[model samples]
Target: MKLVSVETPEKSVCKMTFSASAEELETASNAVYERTRASYTIKGFKKGEADRAQIEADRGEHTFWYDAINDLMDKDVPALYDAALAEHGFVPVDAPVYDLVSVKKDEGFVATATVALQPELNLTKTTGFTTECVTPEVTDKEIDSVLERRRNAAAELVPHKGPAVKGNIVHIDYEGLLEGKPFQGGTAQNQTLQLGSGRMIPGFEEGILGHKAGEEFDIFVTFPARYHAKDLAGKPVIFKIKLIDVCVRQIPALNSDFAKKVANVDTLDELRAQVKQQLHDGKHASALNRAKDQILTQLADAAEGDLPSTLVESTYQLQMQQIQQQLQMQRLSLDRYLSQIHETRESFTAKVRTSAEKTARVRMALLQIAQQENLVPTEEEIDKQLAERAERTKKTLEEVKAQANVHAMRRNEGIRKAADWVIEHSTIEDK
Candidate 1:
């Protein structure tokens, strides 16, 4: 093969013209014939016995020509394209559309490709984009709430011989009636209810208050307007209640011994301190992460570049497909989902396009930053990433490599490193 010329008709488009030698094209044609000759049925010849010339004569003069060109397309064209781009120092962001100029048995073929190049960004304000971050303080009430949960977790259930009370677990047989008729999902026997837990309709649990085991009575309540079941919402109902049994919860006392047993701390004060510090640290880390996201978003928003239309369109299509797939998983139609989210098709499409454009900008900006700061991951890092992916998917490393898009993987990791770099180089101030 010979490379004739390389031209960039636009900043985002590359055009390359190349030709294949006659020997190469003939070899490819013969290879294609050899691979497909078994399927050819020639007159007075057994299957797979016909030579290329006989098949060609019976078929057409250009019978093997198209397949051979396509075969070269699959075999050598990509390497040539990459080599040409490398020599000229250009990286394509999207697939190329090719045009076949001419082809013949003697002269071989000449072709031209129009490729989309990745947009290089001139990134500004890559650091010190201030964002609001609140320093978290854990109140004593919050700490006490945590400790109270621990106490309840260690509580024991003990049988009660007499009347039920708030915080007592009760077993009962009952039927609920609306308009003097039993409704669907309104009857059960020996159903358990923890009084004051608010698990049942309001006034239903409190109705069991002071009722001893084996007592039978009727309690009335109305469902809340916002209830999930529309038929029952905001409707008054009568429940025939029978108390079968009751049990009181015996919660642990909050003390030094309780702290030592539950939290492995020497004293209650020490346990409180530990819980408070852990909560503050977790909240602080979350705040900082959100601030970092804001900073990078601003950086990408400030980045200057005209995104390639091909990349933007492809990304937009992919995102739309993904959204449609998600809607399918939820057993919904796209129109219905939009209605539920209060968006019309036009607005939704605009939103999707905006998001896709922003995504392209973010990627371009981060990659540029990565090039400038040397934050690109090494081969070992990529291998580790692949190994982690293999572990997560329960596949062998080789299988992961075979199925994974390695170039995308490298780009993603580099973008991630660049994002972290942007965050690390900036300071998030307290609001």
Candidate 2:
């Protein structure tokens, strides 16, 4: 394979004309024929005894060329691409899309490929930008909140004969009617609800308050104007409610025994200390994240380059896929989530594109810095990371090493080192 011509059709876009040698094409064609000859029965020749000329005459000269070209593409294009990358010094941001230009029986094939390339960055500022990250402090209130949650989790529910109150679970049967007629999705049996939980529409749970067990009553509620159901939006409805029973949570006492039972700590003091440390660690991580974001934003702002639309779109797609996976894990639909968040598709898309562009710019700046510094992970560093990965994943070091893509690892580590360098060189002010 050979690169005949290279052209930059647009910024961050490379168009290259390349070809497979005639000899290589002929060899591939012959191999294809040899593999399928036993199945081919020419007009005058028996199976497996047909010559290339005979087969070409029987079929077409270009009959086997397509598969041969595809085989060469699979076996040879990648090596050619790598060579072009080295010789032309163009970093590809996406896979090259190839188009066959022309092909002849003995003259091999000519092809053109277009690829999106990484923008050459000239960052005006690389260091000394100030980053603000506040050191987080833990307080007794936060610790108490954690303890309260633990108590809530350990609470037991007891039947209450009195009126339903906030934090009490009420079991009831309800049938809603619009203008004295039964409506769709307006009936439920043996349903349990918590008053003041806000799980139901406005005025529904509020009416349950002060209602005693065994009482049968009706509550009127007007659906919000923005309700998802168009027919029910802003409409007043009456729900016949039958109060079965009310249950109240009996919380345990906050003591050393409680601490030991809830958290495995010997005493309340020890539990508080543990909670405080956990909170402190979380705050520290949050602070560091803020610092990283600030530093990257500043670096990206200082960079001047053309961001490939393909790269940004790819990143956006990856981000969306990750969100979809997370939503699937939570058994939620993306459209429903967007509705709950009060976001429209167009607005959300615009926001995501902005974020993706910023991310692309930041990554490009970091990669350029890494290249400029000739940054690469050391063998010891690589081994240490591999060991850590093995430990975390419960795999053997040999298995982890076998699965590791060393080149990719080196590239990613180099980019990370560049990020660390930027952070280290920056002026970080802690509040």
Candidate that scores best on TM-score: 2
Note the Cα lDDT for every prediction shown: 0.86, 0.87
TM-score of each: 0.53, 0.57
The regions of model 1 sitting more than 4 angstroms off are 1-117, 125-132, 163-246, 253-257, 266-268, 309-356, 378-380, 387-395
| Every model: Cα RMSD to truth | 11.8, 11.3
Residue-level lDDT of model 1, residues 17-114, one tens digit each, is 88888898999889889889899889989988999989988988688888888887767777888899899888776567788999988999998887
What TM-score would you give candidate 1 relative to the actual structure?
0.53
Candidate 2 residue-wise lDDT at 427 = 83
Candidate 2 lDDT trough over 10 residues, lowest sum: 405-414
Which stretches of model 2 miss by more than 4 angstroms? Answer: 1-5, 16-72, 93-114, 135-145, 148-253, 261-266, 378-407
On lDDT, the candidate that comes out on top is: 2
Which lDDT value does model 1 have at 422? 83
